[model samples]
Target: MAFREMFSKNHRTTDAAPPASTETGRDDTSFYDLKHKIHGRLIEETNLAALDSMDPAEIKTEVGGVVEYFLQEEQALLNEEEKRQLIVEVLNELMGLGPIEPFLKDPTISDILCNTYKDIFVERFGLLEKTSARFIDNAHLMNIIDRIISRVGRRIDESSPMVDARLPDGSRVNAIIPPLAIDGPILSIRRFAVNPLKMQDLVNYRTLTPQIAEFLAGCVKAKLNIMISGGTGAGKTTLLNILSGFIPANERIVTIEDSAELQMQQPHVVRLETRPASIEGTGTVTQRDLVRNSLRMRPDRIIIGEVRGAESFDMLQAMNTGHEGSLTTIHANTPRDSLTRLESMILMTGTNLPESAMRFMLSSALDLIIQSTRLTDGTRKVTAISEVVGMEGEVITLQDIFVFEKKGVDKDGKVLGRFMATGIRPKFADRLELAGIEVPEDLFSIDRYYE
Candidate 1:
């Protein structure tokens, strides 16, 4: 027998039923069996031939009709309460998509925003476009949110109705409901590329050129403390992952993230993810908690997936104190903004450090900042490669070793720019020499840039 046919008769519907309804008088094993039976029977009885002809919504409606037929056939065996519960179960199975499909299938969409049941928006190429994909209603949306958070061992309700989770595909999910959201349910999904984009692939997309790629590789090889900066959908994490490829395959790496999206190709990579508190408000693992813990693991390179909040302070401390060649990303518009953002995050640690002290720490901890931007033409590109040159009094000083100079726009509305080098050789090059990596002195000559 086929798989669906086998499940139709022998499988228990209990597994598919809602948790609330599972408590009903029905036996879970029997209910699970009936559900699979109904699903198989519904598909058989319906116009399976015409399935391709119908829209997804219409197909769902027709499937609902089959469910009603199955319920009527079993009406004599079930009481009124059991029958009512079955109706809800059938509808949920037919109408609700498990919370993982939209994120995996969408190639162009970078982010999925769910403000409420009625509002859904997805960011495609830097523009937010409304989508027809939606839940059955607010209640249905809440059910999915419940199912998802429950699997991750998180919680959501009136009292603690906000949650952060990762779908099976590693897409980051943030959800807020009821009192906290006030707009029914709010869910934001930051989609991850199921297949991580590699550096060569990014170059094929015109995101960066080969020369800049070699330079970034050199920076990674030289153990330059590098931070990637960008706005939402600006490809900061993607660039970070690609840059991480330059690390020698022999070195041990520790990657820390809230959701664990970085796909480092190194064989010795240790992945650490943060944990959420249980329903009773116990067993929480914050990013700060993980960063501090990763320190003891003796990573050749410690990479915090993204530095936000107090974790920035610990990450900066790690880079300054023996963790060279460390990597992290930040949300900012420009390289300077990235430094300011780091300062703000460091202060979030509640250190109460003076502004000058924070600036000094940032300047000393960071060696290079690669800033990326999503241009008006709907493409994200690396715009500047800057070197941190220590602090001047109250201000952190930086020199752009390489910058993207946009000459002009093409007729097709694409922005054209060249990543040119500056004469300033990074202070860490001497250390790279000891590692048997030789970057020609002329590679950093500003006059030779764009030649």
Candidate 2:
């Protein structure tokens, strides 16, 4: 059945129908039918291989001409505005992400999620809303997915039903097809901002106060090792990028990630990305390998994008040896949980180090943990700035330098809270002073919140 016909029977009174459905009933039905007819004709008439080699502008012009000719030939009833829109949609189908192109262009949309051919959702302001966009069918969605993965030198089929890739614009994409995906092919795209979020931008969004930001900048300047901890989508990587900006421009920094996402403006920076196994299941490079190799590159600082496994051990070793001002992120809810996660990841290396020794290593290496959280209201906040003082026996001790205390949610469900200093001065104050980074004395005043 045609897309319009599939929904035609369910239509109530014209006034009750959604604006899109009502619009479709009025003229969109004819538009889709005309679009379908023109698409078939174009497929049969155009030289797709030759068209691929032509410049994009030329291809668009040729396609536009064909669309105009088809409209005239078929005597399709379309107004000027409808014809223009149809042209754009047809061109998008030919060269872009089709139905999802508009969402990709929407700067406010942070994520595009496709659960099935007809079920499409977009996340805006941390809330998911169903979109009017959809695929024609399962086969149509799979074709788009195949095209996306193929561009990145990857493939997904029965042999390989799952793949992770990125768009040309650096948005992270993950797709899983059946039999792995029982519901249908699943595609999730985490869009990257065209203008990367800076520290001031984050402050404006109330992710962290300026005082904590200044403290973090000072820690980075003083060559302290920092780990950002958070759950998925909690803005951990974003904070890592902002903190990295504090590094001196003259220092050489090395960044390693599974997929390169960090946009560092530093002139002396080296970025490394891991490689997935080839079709023959050979020549895969893991993050652990990158971390181990970064040591010999004589980097003044090393930034692991995130320590998911054995790489955590190597990252700690780098910190314990000589590399300071190093930064990384991990998946955890709290500062303490971050340490536990690190300990678990270190064991994945098969190091067989005693628990006491591992705790001691963690305590010695990590100077601070900045815990980020996405609260119920969908606002991300840096909930804790914890200093890893040292090992108290087998336990790694931590003291909060700053914390976000929740009062209550307002009537509109907005979270009401304040970021307050813990009054306890950080052990690194002396070190920071020695490094010529002067933090204000009143910044740590008891119960005081930086307005």
Candidate 3:
């Protein structure tokens, strides 16, 4: 018998109702078999090579016709809605991200994590939950991974085994397979928001108070070098993007990242991304290389996505050498940890300077450290905003201008806290005034609390 005829015969034989105990198991197996068969038939019967040359709309129309013909010829038992859903899924498998396309389209889903072909999860509103999405098998999952990385001129195979890539819409994707990913092909996608959040949106989200936002805007406008510190997924990049909006449109800005995710609204912005080595293990571009190159570009401000290594030294140098208003992020739990992390990253540069000299350079180069935190309640908040006062003795002194004090957790598991001004005015206030920016004195009044 032909392929379609044989498939239909087997499907019909298994279509008979089974005993109660085995009914659910049989049904699941039958569905997987049917889906697999249909997917195979679509691949075999359709002229995918020709479809590739067509526009997206044309390809969808052509693929829909093929699916309709197959459904009719196979005489499959499915309702209209079921058949329509099947066509969409088949099209997704053909031209778009197969199983996770729905999650990518979902605005509320912030992350899509595929642990294996059979296991998948998504994060919505800061909480992770398992999703029904899955690949047919390991081979199926590998095909999708290849498709994603290849689009960005990158690859993942036994030779490399790991890669980072971006979707057409700028969503970040990381994949590891085989020897590196013993479980199976592992993929993690950090979806970029279709609608990027603004400073006012963050204020409404209670990430920070309006007063804190205002102060940050003033600091940015006054050209103070600011460093944002937080743990992973603590909203550091989001806050950096917001602060970047404060830069005047007239001044030029340079942004550097391993993957370009920052969305700057300023017109005079130049974005740079680091290049990984080619398959032959040549042509690698490091972040430190980009930072040193950015200085010669005459940038009014330089924004590093996150300084994780030797680039930290160049970033501090940029700030000390007249590149004011530079914004960057680092992975650390607190403001103090952020400073320590910077010192360690600078040390990674193999500089022979003593720790004291590094501390002095950090204190002089960075004027503010905005600390973000992800609380137990799944809400992100700016826990502390400190001014990097000049060195006192051998230690780098910092004065907290605003802090989030935790009172308790509510019955609903929500964090109960208030953002309060510590009463100690920032030394940069005079600098802000000198730059023709005026912030109300009461904005920093002692014991002032915002609930």
Once fitted onto the true fold, the runs of candidate 3 whose alpha carbons sit more than 4 angstroms away are 1-29, 49-61
Compute each candidate's TM-score over C-alphas: 0.77, 0.90, 0.91
Best by TM-score: 3
Task: Report the C-alpha lDDT of model 2 over 263-350, residue by residue, as the tens digit.
Answer: 7879999999888888888989999999899999999999998889989998999999999889999999999999999999888889
Question: Candidate 3 on 239-268: residue-level lDDT in tens?
Answer: 998899989999999999998899889889
Give the least accurate 10-residue stretch of model 2, judged by summed lDDT.
1-10
Worst 10 residues of 3 by lDDT: 1-10
Encode model 1's per-residue lDDT on 35-75: one tens digit a residue. 65665565454445555566766655566555554554543
Give the Cα-based TM-score of candidate 3 against the true structure.
0.91
Q: Evaluate model 3: give its lDDT.
A: 0.86
